[model samples]
Target chain A: AQSVTQPDIHITVSEGASLELRCNYSYGATPYLFWYVQSPGQGLQLLLKYFSGDTLVQGIKGFEAEFKRSQSSFNLRKPSVHWSDAAEYFCAVGSAEGYSTLTFGKGTMLLVSP
Target chain B: EAGVTQFPSHSVIEKGQTVTLRCDPISGHDNLYWYRRVMGKEIKFLLHFVKESKQDESGMPNNRFLAERTGGTYSTLKVQPAELEDSGVYFCASSQGYGETQYFGPGTRLLVL
Candidate 1:
C-alpha cells in the first residue's frame, strides 16, 4: 500500500513571495506523482505530474515540481505567489498499475497574505 | 468538453436518512472514481468504475453505501441509514484510460446531522 505525507498542515506566504510545499511518498516501486490545487468552491485542478523523462515538471500557473527518487519527494514550488494563489494543495502518489486509484496526502492549505 | 459534474452540490440529511449522489463524467471517459474527504482528513478513494462494471471497491466503508454505474455513462452512490460519520465531501473523477490524468468534479458536500 502506498501513502503520502505532507508535513505542513497550513502555510502562509506573503504576496509576491516564493513558496514551497513539501510532499513525500511511500511506495514500493517507481511512483507517478501529481500536484493538485483546489480553490474555494472549485474543483481540483491538476498542477503537474511526473511520469517519466525529465525530473523537473512544469505545470500551469507558473508552478513546478521536481522528482527526487533518493528523497522520495515531489515538492511543489513557485517563484512568486499572488493573492489568487491561496488554495488547498494536495500531493498524490500513484503507480503505473492502477495509478488511477491515487493515494493522496492530507493536503496543505496555502494562504497568501498581502 | 464539460468536466465531471456532480449533482446536488450540497446535501444535508439527518442521521438514519437516505441520500443519493450522482456523477456525470466527461464524454468518452472510460474510468470513473469516487472519493471522500472527512473533515480535516485526506481524500480517500471509495471505488473505481471501469465503464459499467466495478473495477475496484476496496475502499468502500461499509455495506450501507452502494454505488452503481449502469450503461457505462453516469454513476450514482446511495447511502442508506446514513450515519454521522458519513458527513463529508464526496468527489467524482473521470479519466480517459488507465494511468491517465483524472479530472475531478466540484464534489457534493454531504452533511449528516
Candidate 2:
C-alpha cells in the first residue's frame, strides 16, 4: 500500500516571507502527486497536481511544487506568503493502476503572521 | 456553475442515533466519491460511485455505513447507530470521469454526542 508523510505538523511564517512545505510519499511505481489547501470551515481546494512531463508544476495563487523522483518528494513553495495563506495543506499520492485511491498525509498547518 | 454541495453543513446527534448526509455532485460528473476526515487523521476514502452503481466500496469502514446514489446524480451516506468514532467531517467529491481531477464539497461536519 502507498502512504504519504508530511514531516511538519505546524509551520509559522511571517507575512511576505517565503514558504516551503515538505511532502514525501512511498509508492511502488510512478505516482501522481497533488497538493491541496483547506481553510477553516472550507472545503479543500487544489493547489496543484503532478501527473507527468515537467518536474516543476505551477499552481494558482503563485504557488508551485517540484517533483523530485530521487527524493520521493513533492514540496510546495511560494516566493511570498500572505496572511490569507494560512491554512492546512495536504499532500497526496495516487497510483498509476487507475483504480487506486489517493493516499494523503496528515497535513501541515501553515501559519502566516503579520 | 456551482461546485459540489452537501446538505446540513453541520449536524449534532446523540450516540446510537441514525444520521444521513447528502451530497449533490457537479452536474455531468460521472464519478462521485465519499471521504471522511477524523480529528488528527488524514482524509480517508469511504466509497466511490460511478453513476448509480458502486464501482468500489472497499474503503467503507463497516456494514453500518450505507451509501447510495439514485439516477446517477446525487448520493446519500447513512450511518445507523452512530458511534463517537463516526464524528468527523464527511466530504463529497466528484470527477468528470475515471482518473480525472476531483472537485470537493464544503463537507458535512457530524458531531456524535
Candidate 3:
C-alpha cells in the first residue's frame, strides 16, 4: 500500500515571502508525485508533477517542487507568494504502472497575508 | 476545453434518504474516477472507470454505494440509505488515458442530517 503525509495542517506567509510546503510519501518503488491546489468552491488544479529526470520540477503559477528520494519527500516551493496564493494544497503519490490509483495527503491550508 | 463537470453542486438529505450525483467528463477522455473527502480526512479514491467498464472499485465503502457509467459518456453515483458518516464532498475526475494527469470537477457537497 502507498500513503502520503503532509506534516503541516496550515501555514501562513506574508506577501513576497518565500514559502515551502512539506510532503512525504511511502511507496515500494519510484512513485509518480504531484501537487494540486484548490480554491474555495473550485476544483483542484495541478501545480506540478514528478515522473523522472530532473529533481526540481516547475509548475504553473510560479510554483515548483523538488523530489528528494533519500527523504521520500516532494516539497512545494515558491520564491514569493501572493495573496491570491492562499488555498488548500494536496500532495499525492501514484504508481508508475499507470493503472494504480493515487494516494493523497491530508492537505495543507495556505494563508497569504499582506 | 471545458473541464469535468458535476451536477447538483450541493445536496442535503436525511440519513435514510438516497442521493444521486452526476459527473460529465471531458470529451474524448477514456478514464473517469470518483473520490471523496470526509470531514478532516484525506481525499480517498472510490472507484475508477475506463469508458463504460468499471476497472477498479476496491475503494467503495459498501453496497449502499452504486456507480454506473452508461455508454461511457457520463457517470452517476447513487447512495442509498445514506449514513451520517457519508456527509462529505464527492469529486469526479477524468483523464485522457491511464496514468495521465486527471482533471477534476468542482465536486458535490453532500450533507446528511
Task: Tell me the whole-model lDDT of each prediction, alpha carbons only.
Answer: 0.96, 0.94, 0.95
Q: What is the lDDT of residue A111 in candidate 2?
A: 92
- The best candidate in terms of DockQ: 1
TM-score of each: 0.99, 0.98, 0.99
lDDT of 2 by residue, A46-72 (tens): 999999999999999999999999999
A10-108, model 1: which lDDT tens digit per residue?
Answer: 999999999999999999988999999999999898999999999999999999999999999999999999999999999999896557599999999
Candidate 1 segments whose C-alpha is farther than 4 A from its true place: none
Could you tell me which 10 consecutive residues in candidate 1 chain B have the lowest summed lDDT? Answer: B95-104
When 1 and 2 are scored with TM-score, the better candidate is: 1
Per-residue lDDT of candidate 3, residues A19-87 (tens digit):
999999999977999999999889889899999999999999999999999999999999999999999
Number of colliding residue pairs in each model = 0, 0, 0
| Alpha-carbon deviation at A37 in model 1, angstroms | 0.5
Extract clashing residue pairs from model 1.
none
True-vs-predicted CA distance for residue B29, candidate 1, Å = 0.3
Q: Write the per-residue lDDT of candidate 1 for residues B2-34, one digit (tens) a residue.
A: 899999999999999999999999999999999
The TM-score of the first chain in every model comes to 0.97, 0.97, 0.97
Sort candidate 3 into its docking category: high
Give candidate 2's TM-score.
0.98
